[model samples]
Target: MMHLTSRYLISLASFIVLTSMAVAKTNPACLKHLGGGYGDAECYHGLSADITADNDKLYRNLRATIPLGNAHQKLLNDYMASQNDAIKYCELQRNAGAQWKAEHDGSMFPALYEQCVYNIRKTQSTFLQDLLKMANWK
Candidate 1:
């Protein structure tokens, strides 16, 4: 019984490692940015799985290739600033949409909120992509 259990445990561990490697290749950035729990496609509310996968690829590439040091720090800071701005902008838009929906007695579309977030992410990704090109990352 002991021998059988040890072999089973080893097989399980190997399977887990291989599965995660495959998943990482498909959505490498999701884990780096969102961490383990929220990294999967199910966490991306509005966008289709395909779109999220593409964004993950872009983010992963940017993260992997970005040069290190002060310039990289500055780039990260700029991204945070943009995120703050996006938050405010999205809040205003959401409020407005809420009021309009209320007036028209329409159902709330949760996807709208997700779409807003996705747009901000896309913009930030594009900026980073440009920066990466300028820095000549291979």
Candidate 2:
């Protein structure tokens, strides 16, 4: 009886651990955008692609080494300063899309928009952190 109880406890513990990991791994925000069905995957994929392209462009612009006069340099500086905020704005839009999907019973456009927003936030956060570290901003 003692051995059986111990085995049962271990199995229960393992199940709990696995369940927690699955939940943690899932992007609930992304799933929320998925809405009631599975058909929205394509929309999510497209939005993610779009945001990724935007992030790529921003990275290229930031990494450009072209020399500029004070005025142009100031423009670059301003852009760098506001880039994170812009990314956050995109994230908000994405969240709004997710919310719309949830409210509307899983519309594809909203689901895709939410995914785009989440991707933008994730990409922007990572990129901005790297950029700031390289520039010794923080």
Candidate 3:
């Protein structure tokens, strides 16, 4: 009885692990609609890194541009605003993904995923441009 129970436990654990992996690896149908694949994953990851770097550069540039009273204070305010906007954008993407999945099923899943990634990158670029402009302003 003890041996049987141990075997069952191991099997259950294995099953759970496999299920989790499948869930994680399976991209949402919307992602497919956007054209997401392994390449999309790579692109998104790289874009995320670039966004981080650009944000840092924006902060530095802002510091350089505004040497007036409490520059650091203004920087904090701007950074917080940008961060909040980014969080909101991510939430929008999550909701959009769910809606897309319900409407499209799994058809063209890769294309959808790619489009989602592209949208993210486009948003990031716009955000960075705005930040840079603010930093450059007099």
Candidate 4:
């Protein structure tokens, strides 16, 4: 059951990231579509998905640099484990958001949460990119 759940989550995450990736690549920039709330949310969600995909690709590239061995297999396994761990992170994010919404009680909660998540993903993507550079990968 646990394995199936992780597999499902991975598939779902892949679908989302790949789906948004196309729009994300075309824009390059998530230039805020202001006035319309839907547009701004789209910007945040799209950019977040893009950054998530970027981080995944960078880590995969880093792993690829390692020759096939026990260590390589371990890295591959760790990547899947990390994806499973992301479910826990999402739970934490929701809990924190609930607390904040309870205190503030505004329409901005959803957008603010999405923006915060985007920032976190962006940071992770940048960090992964730096790691790739340090490894001399293109």
Candidate 2: clashing pairs of residues = none
Name every residue pair that clashes in candidate 1.
Answer: none
Q: How many backbone clashes can be found in candidate 4?
A: 0
lDDT of 1 by residue, 78-97 (tens): 76566647745654554576
Could you report the Cα RMSD, in angstroms, for every candidate shown? 8.8, 9.9, 9.9, 12.0
Task: Tell me how many clashing residue pairs each candidate has.
Answer: 0, 0, 23, 0
Write down the TM-score of every candidate.
Answer: 0.46, 0.34, 0.42, 0.54
Model 4, global lDDT: 0.65
The residue-by-residue lDDT of candidate 2 on 15-84, one tens digit each, is: 9999886544333356445553444655455545555555666555655643555465566556655754
- For model 1, give the 10-residue run with minimal summed lDDT: 35-44
Q: Which tens-of-lDDT digit does each residue in 34-108 have in candidate 4? A: 443555556776777777777778878877766778576686567546653554454355447667334554344
lDDT of each: 0.56, 0.56, 0.57, 0.65
RMSD of 1: 8.8
Which candidate gets the maximum TM-score versus the true structure?
A: 4
* Model 2 worst lDDT window (10 residues): 23-32
Model 3, residue 96: distance off in Å is 3.5
